[model samples]
Target: MTDRDSVFLRALGDAASRLRPEVHEYVAGPPAGSRSGVGRGVFEIAGSPYRRIAGLLRIVSGPDVALDAYERDVPFEIVNRLAADGSRPRLDAERSFRFRRGPRRFVDTLQVGRIPGTLVNTPGTDGRVELLLECSVTADGNLMMQSRAARVRIGRRRIRLPKLVSVKVTVIDGWSPEHEHRTVDVSVRNPVLGTVLRYRGWFPYEYVPS
Candidate 1:
């Protein structure tokens, strides 16, 4: 698909072209030699410190949603698919994290938002929550994105969450010459609870056979 047909491109607008080559390839897919993009990585630090908060998140987001006992050097697998859904372009992914307790997965889908220059992120096994994110490509070619507005769907109705329950997520993605891999860091915070979850890691990615 062309850049115009990419979910990330639509969200970053003109800035999409400025993203680092590696991040751009991951975001704007059907990567060159393969049918899909796959990455295997290890998270230097993973999981939330608050046990109660982690458990509650898992229950509300569905069982497969990301939650685990705090651990270091946690291995994970990521598979990303970018394709046109009828007239819309969407990005879908599933990241499996290997934890001591068990293997847990975080699944998500991203699509162009109704408002231009934005993207909608739906995360979780059931995708009960939807977030509107604003993204940019920095001068150094890194990708920076944040989301503050979120809504939760219940049956046929959707409720816009207030600050107390809503979360602010900040994500950064870029290439790491020092590590000779791609690196990413994500922070999910709440206004009242401070930093609830955070993770950072590096990975060597490739366009693998679908």
Candidate 2:
């Protein structure tokens, strides 16, 4: 696959071959003639550790950016559209979660990072956060991605977040034959609070015609 069509392909480089066939295809974006990859499923557990913290985040990041509810068996849908940012590959992802009060949505665009073999996901508001992601593959053929750095962009100025205040993430994506679906487990944490937001769920995915 061409790097312009897949940011994960460029970020993973040689390791891209290590990903299982299905997983690789998923990360490589949709195939030719397809517009995007779509998935719908229910999260066995999804929520923030503290509602007050979530509310505080909403004030800064936008209301739909953070979920104020803690609930189980929440249904959600995710769409990943692949596109080009000039010469670079970009993935625009939108997620909508079914919360008790209403739908809580999160959107992000991931692009090639400043450094090779890494990615930057800009999520939330215009200047909410830019996450630096480093990826790895597990022996069992799962994908492990971690966020070690982040920054806030305000017009022409960009401010780096200190480790103590920056958010950290651990994500694992794998194929489960027993369940016949793709599985994802994600944990979002902070230095002060452990895992503030987390979710693990399985979903079947398919590419949509362009």
Candidate 3:
């Protein structure tokens, strides 16, 4: 990657970290809905089966994380404007995907309870197929995640896909020197899947007071 790309990724990484609610600030109990304490963004996707798979993941992920309403109330237009450029083409809109933080790492899980209306073949019965991803941040603030242990679980059956999957995400937030908005740039891939999902876009999101 070029120096410009590296700088861009680091900026995006900061945005990603700022978007998550501080675990210490949790209100109480479990979240009421995906909207509570969650961030939301709209992304443009690419690829074939992976693009379709990403769409499925979006519907189940819900809103982004927002622990504090005041701090997380960034407008979608801001993010949208930040992503507006001629570098990449927009394919589809992925809205309201949420990320939750844990004690050790951050997690984004997609709970697929029903099949998508657009999909022809159903993957399973009425059971839920969840896509659980765990991520950790490097000291430099670039977000990193590996799919080596990622799972696609259908009810009680856990299926760990074969292949090494990894991603480095960066987020540009309000404090950015160049831009004062929040946006995300993510590159995710598996050896077998190649570029599973690569998107750069922005969306409107808010925090639900716990």
Off by over 4 Å in 3: 1-134, 139-143, 164-175, 203-205, 208-210
The TM-score between candidate 1 and the true structure equals: 0.90
| lDDT, candidates in the order shown | 0.79, 0.81, 0.31
What lDDT score is found at residue 86 in candidate 1? 89
lDDT of 3 at 179: 44
Report the C-alpha lDDT of model 2 over 24-137, residue by residue, as the tens digit.
767878777987989999888887868677777765555456767778898999999988878888888888889777778878888888887788888775646778999888
lDDT accuracy of residue 120 in candidate 2: 88
Where is model 1 poorest over a 10-residue stretch in terms of lDDT?
A: 1-10
Give per-model CA RMSD.
2.2, 2.0, 16.2
TM-scores for all predictions = 0.90, 0.92, 0.37
Most accurate candidate by lDDT = 2
TM-score of 2: 0.92
lDDT of 3: 0.31
Candidate 3 vs. truth: CA RMSD? Answer: 16.2
Clashing pairs in 2: none
Residue 209, candidate 1: Cα error in Å is 3.0
> Which residue pairs clash in candidate 1?
none
- Looking at candidate 2, what is the lDDT of residue 15? 89
